[model samples]
Target: MKKENVVIITPCFNENTTVIAFLKQIEEVAGKLPFLFEVIVVDDCSSDQTLSMLQKFSFVSENITLTILPLRFNVGHQSAIYQGLLYAQHLDADKFIIMDSDGEDDPEAIAELVKFNDYDIVNVARGRRKESISFQISYYVYRFIFKIITGKILNFGNFCMIKKKVLETSCHTSFIHFAAHLSKQKVKSTSITFNRLKRIDGKSKMNLTSLVHHAFKSFVEYAEELLMVFLRIFILVILLFFGIIGVVLYKKLFTDEAILGWASTMTVNLFTAALVCVGFFVMGILLLNMISRRNQNKTEIFVKLAEKSELLNQN
Candidate 1:
């Protein structure tokens, strides 16, 4: 086969219900593109028939590569995506796009994503979402927390095109805190909005609870990136202390400086309490860094095993 220049990596987990239709739609969409392209489905050890579905397609489409990264257990969605991105990098695709196995993220938007090739990455903004009211509320809360943590406004959903280099670089990053990390590089980005469709086949793999967990983990993963927050807090604390001291000194100089008893005492106590909380939050992050280091070590071990397995199969 001619060298495949562009590829689409769709991460799957128990998506057997939608895999066939999704693959068919992807095929039709790719057929319209000008260059040679491949669709890689990274199966995340689905307990359902997802593996079998991918096997069937693998036998048929010469250009289609189905990578079954069967985890020892049920890895989360983001981990599955990272695995797909790794596969794409290994396959040497010039560019790659990640989409959900479910049809909600339209595969037809790939053309618009390709237009922003000048940028290292472009995320497709879901102009609309087909989600329950509760999910919508939770999503906005997560977004607010993300902005507070990262100090930047992030746009778009996970659906978008990324250069091969950005995909590889992002996978290795320790701060998995924000999806915007994919676009954090020096790259121009443009957004294209697509109407989010309701699921046609399988139920959404992500629920409210799972979404909450994902949001938390991503924030923790990117904790180190928020060092500036710590610095700013420290600076504010110093300034606040000085400001309070100046106020107290001025009052003493101008007034008789009498009768200010419990209120003044309580105010100082509150300032001290705030400082203590900030200290603990910073230390908690340090603890998290230790835990993340352990996770990265495990990931490295897995990568080694994957590499050895590949070498053996090649031989």
Candidate 2:
């Protein structure tokens, strides 16, 4: 029987110190699997030696192939992965896997992710993160807000194996947040819980500000749904405003308690505040709608400037 082609896409910015070890780990994992594996390392125009290191690296296993995609400019992690996926579209592959180049995304989980052929996508849900307390707190908060906004629980990152069809479907949409976008897909999917590992070398690239920005990007992926949610809230607030006015009028006309000037002033002030809130909500909804439209029309700009390095092993 012919072996299936499996492509793995990993994006890195300045991971020169840990990238080699990560690639070696991937190579070791690929050697044990029966499928033919191709690893695509997308370098986000690293200012350091990341691109050089990737270009010089060699794989020992015959089953593994290394393809390095160096972008013309730094397009961030999500876009880097998108570029990798776009590049992989031309390759003949059965399954595509996306994971972080840092050691945090355990290479061993690749085995577990690929075992299920019945599913179109198999994701590695984050069980426990080994980051600092503050980072953990912030991540939990982000997840909470994501649940409140998108109405979906996000337990997975960009660590999963996807079929070619899923890849094709995803390539059409904006991959602002890979896992979040994939979660919105209607494909057959399953997830396995796994503890996140620590980095192999150097400190984490993601800081508090970056985490917040990342969370915002994920929210952007669900802009349309979030807009609808806010619209409902806006409508409810308008109804409540009218209800309050009705109650005030009834208290003045029917109730024995006299509505003083202070009471009338307070009611006007409250309604004025509500009107401001309504204005803000309307602006927010408009912004979200614009973002949703922009995302839908987003073009694959990375394809034009990305340069592909030669495959590590010809044979």
Candidate 3:
């Protein structure tokens, strides 16, 4: 019986201080696994020495292979991972794993993901995040809003193992957000909880603005669903406006409680406010629809493979 091939794809940008240690940890873990593991690191046009270090790095195990893909430009985190998946599609592999180069995604979790051979996709959900209190609070609030809008709870990141069949289907779709896009797919999926670890080197690269943009991308993945939710709200507001009109008319015509010039003025003001709200909601729906169309058309982004090398210990 031949061992299956497993390709691990991790994206990094200016991670010079921690990328080498991350690869070594992966090597140590891959040597113990039963599968032939290949690591593909996608560098998102880093200006630092990250690419140089990756070009010089070596692995000790004969069963492990390393491939480096440095993009032509910085296409952000999600697009970089998508480029890796596109490249891995041509490689001879039975399974693919995606994760962050930062130590937060434990290399040891690879073993847990691979053990579940029955699942099409196995996700390592975040149990306890080790970030600051402010970051955690913001993340919790984003999750709450996401669930309320899309009716789906997002608990996992990019740390997951996917079978080859799942990869074939996923590569054809838009990956604005990896985990969220996968969640929408109807596949045999399961998740295991793992506490997120701290970075191996200095502070995180993502700031508050970047984190908020990242959260918004997840919402973009479910744009149609969000549009429907807004449409329903718009309908409810319109119905409430008509109900108010009916009450005002009853007071003016059927009873003597109507004050002079007050009923007409109130009705006109209420009508104007309702029109403004309706206009805002209609504009929102149009913008979201445009975004959804753009995403559908965005099937691929530009990327370049700067270097490729293989180090096999011939013992």
**What lDDT is obtained when candidate 3 is compared to the true structure?**
0.81
lDDT by candidate, in order shown: 0.67, 0.82, 0.81
Native-referenced Cα lDDT, model 1 = 0.67
Per-residue lDDT of candidate 1, residues 169-269 (tens digit): 76666334336556466666566778887876746666899887777666665556565566577667667667766777777888787635654775576
Give one digit per residue, the lDDT tens place, for model 3 in 1-315.
Answer: 888899999999989969899999898888888889889998887888888788778898988989888776798898899888888888898789999998889888988888888888998999897777988889889889999988888999999999888887777765688988888988899999888888888577666787799897887788677667766765766676677678877887999886556656766766676676677567667767776575466443434442233211110
Q: Which stretches of candidate 3 lie above 4 Å from their native place?
A: 259-315
Residue 69's lDDT within candidate 2 is 77
Alpha-carbon RMSD of each model: 4.5, 3.5, 4.3
Query: TM-scores of all models?
Result: 0.79, 0.89, 0.88
- Shift of residue 210 alpha carbon in model 1, Å: 3.0
Write one digit per residue (lDDT tens) for candidate 2, span 59-97.
Answer: 999989888777767888888888888888878986899
